[model samples]
Target: MASTPVDHSAPDTAARSKVERFRANPWLALTAVSFGLLMVQLDGSVVAIANPAIGRDLGASTAELQWVTNSYLIALAASMILGGKLGDRFGRRLYYLVGIGGFVVTSVAIGLVGSIEGVIGFRALQGLAGGILMPNTLGILRAVFPPKRFALAVGIWGMVSAVSTSLGPIIGGLLVEHVDWESVFYLNVPIGLVALVFSAVVLAESKNSGGRQRFDLLGVVLLAAGLVALVFGIVKGETWGWASAGTLGSLALGLALLVVFGLYETRQEHPLLPMRLFRNRSLTTGAVMTLLNFFVMLGGIFFIMLYLQNVRGYTPVEAGVSTLPMSIASLFASPLGSQLTSRLGARVTIPLGLLLSGAGMFGMLSWSVDSSYATMWPPFVAIGLGVGIVLPATAATIIGNAPVRDGGVASGLQSTMLQIGGALGTSVLITVIAGKVGSSLFGELTGAGVPAGVARGLEKAEDAVTMGIAPVSGDMPAQLRAAVVEGSGQAFVNGLHAAVTVTGVLCVLGAAAAAVFVKGRAEEARDMRAQAEAAGEPVGVVAAH
Candidate 1:
């Protein structure tokens, strides 16, 4: 029997065909990348709406509930830069597939967990997967798209990220109200599966061929330890007493470790984060701006969700629905802000956005037990518009300022700042609110005609409010129920006001920093053009306007 002659060129032909198909349909590539990014963004806030339900079902304490969220954030923040570095060294498509697979498995485990501890553990794993998944989205996009089309692709990427993040609470709320709390985690499973399949089929493998590849295991450990210590200190400050040894020691240790990490990075030939990037004033300013932005944004979301569900007695779906104005405004404002950045420059536009955010936080101070949706929606809109405008400008500033060779590092830094800021904001704000609520609850309740004994009892149970669990109306004595609800509502409002005021002050500081440090349009354009010329890439019109 004779064998047919082997077609030696078949593999090469198939490869060419695949490449041509991808080039012909860039939108299809975008769709696959966006699906993975959407899943990551969605997870960021979806669990927020389900927090109350998770607490009730697991009988978790306020601290435990916080850990559920913080664990994920800390893991994500700590590993993000490393993830980006790994993607650059290895194949992005391979890492992305592993990330999606791990994310799906973790999501399933989280949904099936019987205890809060299990949920927290699984959530951290999910975030680790997210850290791996997210950085590659931009990397893959950059690899596939031409430089001329990069800005447009990034714009669409930013839009998808913003929309998915905004939709999290709404989707989680609907699931929690109609299906189950577990449904929120389970929801990611299907999304991940679809993303994995599409990515495997459409995504091409890409890696940086220029530098020597090395993993900074020591840096990763130090960074993770520092963050955990810092966040732990903040989260536990109320219980440990802010001046106590536990709180002071943890904070001091965290700061010292970070300082060490910075010093170590400076010495390393191939550092996890190249310290030289911070030499760019605009990048530093943009990083600081993003940090503050998420600090206010995430912290505000945590408290507002509690107020709507626990204080105002709205259902999860209703609470989510009430926040629609902010999301809608953000959808419009992000694209508009991109245009404004081109005309006004990040110096003016970034500060303007921060100012709006500060104003929105100030407006939130007027919220009380008696405030209505009309009053609430205005602040929501202000915040949405501010965040919508600020995020893209800040991201552009960071990425734009970097040498083209260091783009991945610049992007990873931005994401790391975002997650860390969110974690810190949630921790610090929750601590402030908890401390205020605990100190004032008894006095306020007694002043409202609650008996001293009953006031003491209610004070003991104040965690219900701070942890996002509503007191069961049926369980309370009819006379005390009304007073208790009113008193607790006032206390929560007071705490919320204090937190918002603090956030407003930070926003003002961020705005001032942006004004001082971010460059004007002409200077930034010149710098970008120089970078492009140095790299031997054509200076696209997108670099100008």
Candidate 2:
């Protein structure tokens, strides 16, 4: 059952009879949905860039710094399924508008927050709103365009997303340089407002049009707590030994809750996640690939932002602009990559794309105190092209295999994976990087010209450089500062090297997963049409050539 081209028929009496069918106005609906939902895509991409500025402005400690990114991502992961179910039960457009409005308002709040606590709280609300918006975008797209044009519309949506991804750093950088970190949040206000106003005018509401459905409140709480605890453990594990009580406790509790979640989901009628979805090899593998790709993509980006600012001594603007070449390059590669997906097929394209990302990540290992833009550009280009190639095709796989009845849930699961993987990636990499920093104590002592005798004394596991603050230990004066600088710089370099290596490996695994497991596009579409026909749902006229 291969997917044929869309049966573009004239507005026949039969074609025009159905409310759901994509008729002469289908593209109109598609465009409106794309524009209306643009804010979520934009926020996911741009918001991370403001982290450094926010930290400085609010005088955040190390632990609280991680919250700047994770708070939004963690809440988004927890609530996405619930949002999708709500969209299915109620009108998607209603939830969509509410979610978009919430995002706009919260972005402004994040901009205005004077304390780290305020930022974290608003970020959680923003994440919840973003969760509601993401699944709705795909659902609305399906409701608008005929099945035939769905891929193209989705492709464009992905392109905008890539654009948004690239936007975060650049926009955040610019605003931070010219105005303040608050401006980055402020920019979203207008863009979101514009999208919100237009959507109210042009978008149509669509839903399951069925009976009431149960909301999984317990599952939501359990899952949110589990992820927060798990991520908190990962981000802090380097500081608190993995064997320490706090680290062990969070891990045990998080895993236990997730286990309970799996058991509860199966027994519930109309479960938030139907176990049957996992039965499809394509869905399982596609979701895994999606998770893996997003993991490396986000991890690498977050790490680079830190590297650029902390180690490279770049301003926020410089760090933002540094990524511009990659972003701009992706703008062109993204569309071209979509065309390649149909031609080469997923097997060829997915692997090739990941291989490119791996190569790019490996290229980043060349970064050092002596390095310049030259060392960074090649890898950035590789990642941009690779990411652009994988995104659209991966999306098609996710949507292609999902049943129309469970569209919102399926889409929500996919969105959850994207956000969760990203959150987890940041958490994991932060720990790894911190470990690299802590272990660099010896190198810093040696590089700073500490006497072999003195350096030997510095070997205890505590912050040895700061430990040098002892009166007897402070005699070296200039040597102590030099050692600290060398150590800190090398620590950053070491962490970047380790992080990129991890990202490259994950990208390879993701590529392999996509190649081996994802379904053929045509087979999925055939299954969808067959299921629709069997359910006594209107299948619409499969347009005559």
Candidate 3:
């Protein structure tokens, strides 16, 4: 019957089939998603390396430079849930595309603007875009991959993140030294373009179709405001004095807003964050552990960069090269963690990861101005291995525990916790370093044999000292200059030692908590199925369309 209607569109038909095949391929979707994820993760690590250059170019103080990183993280942490909710409500593919596009544009703006204030503003914008993109990437994977394969996809996703993070310092160091820091920002353009193209062609749109159409806008506002206030208070406290009324008031307000947000979320029929998800003990513990894990990773990396380049007088490339062990370790550790988690359970894997990380942090206690390469590489490898192991396992636990309908939200929540932990890590650790440096600078300078007058004069540049930069003048006598450098290095190392100690203890405590609280695979799977069944969600494996 259709023989008469055989039109001459064979080539078009073949092209359309090819397009559909590409669109349906899960791996292509992953590849497209990875580009964007790589861009964001790479930017984060690279910028840490570029901070010294940014400060010199823009005349930024230590606090101001901290703002550059803090602003992006805070913005990301605040908006992540909202971004996830929006993707679930709208379409994941659409928002993902928009997010990547916005991120690229904002990155360009950051480079063109050429001012610290402008950089801070654009970095926050870039973060907002990242928040929108990040959770949806996971959501898309959940939608496209069968339930059985989701864990493997997540492992691959974590691997991409590890790789990008590992590459960032080296790429950024090269750009900053050989070219200019702007190149790091500009690097996003090409990767983002590729992502946009592939994602447009390959990703099939998906969303949470089971939910009511209504949104919880108030929850978004409350959460955003609360996170901003908390991060602001922490970042400013370093400069404003923790006892200052501004700091005290900001902290109080933030805590109060977050409390209100929690109470308000429980009342909503369509909450931004479903309070019920926390009912799973494994999920709750995983979220907290994820936070603590990143707190150590991001915070430790930030200071480690400073220590390598500033205190130890390594060039940017040398510093980046030095960190290769950590990056390489993570690259292998991620897949290994996933495999171990599958066999031994998260309860065993996560704490084991944390122990290694904690041990790595403790290793930093031995660091000094004259610390050899031999001294640094071991801790770098340990922390990298630890972070890599925890990342995918915690992600799997958190996302796997949720009802499939809440995939986007769960993904967003996971990313939110990651960013929040990172934000807190960077701000809190820097505060520890700054405060320690401020208090000890005078003694260190004097002890190094600088005259009392010279030492007192140098105290005015405490901001510089905190960054591991000796504020030595060109006109200073050679012997005096050497003393200042020695004193400054000692003071910075003192701060570094203090900061790492705090993080190391926290990591050990987190390991203990994970061991005590996290459920094994079988228990988590049973509870997850039970929860989904009770909620009337399909309790069995769901396949991609």
Q: Go through the candidates in order and give the clash count of each.
A: 0, 2, 0
Give one digit per residue, the lDDT tens place, for model 2 in 1-545. 99888655756656555533433255665565566456676666666666667788899986687677668776787777778777766766788888888888998888787899998999989988988888877766655655555566666767777777777776666766778878777777877777778767666666775467777777767766776676566555656777889988987887888788778888888776677777777777767766776777777787777777666678766887888777776676666665666665556667777899899999988888548889988998898888777776666566656665566777787787787667667767766665665577567656756666665665553232221122223555676756655655665577667778888888888777777776666765576677677655543211111
Residue-wise lDDT of candidate 1 within 1-545, one digit each (tens)?
99999886989999988875774355676788888888888987889878879999999998899889878877787667767767766766677788889898999999898899999999999889988887777666655655445545665676777778878888988888889899998888889999999888777666655656567879878877887787667656656778889999998998899889999999887777788878778989999888888887777777888888778878767877888887887787776776777667889878888889889999998898878888899999998888888887887787667654455566677888888677678778888887788788887777767889978767778777565443536877877887777777788887888889889888888899889889887887777788768766543211100
Off by over 4 Å in 3: 1-22, 51-67, 114-117, 536-545
Residue-level lDDT for 158 in candidate 1 = 69
Q: How many pairs of residues collide in model 3?
A: 0
Clashing pairs in 1: none
- Of candidate 2, the 10-residue stretch with the lowest lDDT total is 463-472
What RMSD does each model have against the real structure? 4.1, 7.6, 3.0
Report lDDT (CA) for all predictions.
0.78, 0.70, 0.86
Tell me the deviation in Å of residue 242 in model 2: 4.5
Off by over 4 Å in 1: 1-28, 55-64, 113-116, 142-155, 238-241, 438-443, 451-462, 465-477, 530-545
Q: In model 3, what is the error at residue 391, expressed in angstroms?
A: 0.6
Residue 41 Cα positional deviation in candidate 1, in Å, after optimal superposition: 2.1
Q: What's the lDDT of the predicted structure labeled candidate 1?
A: 0.78
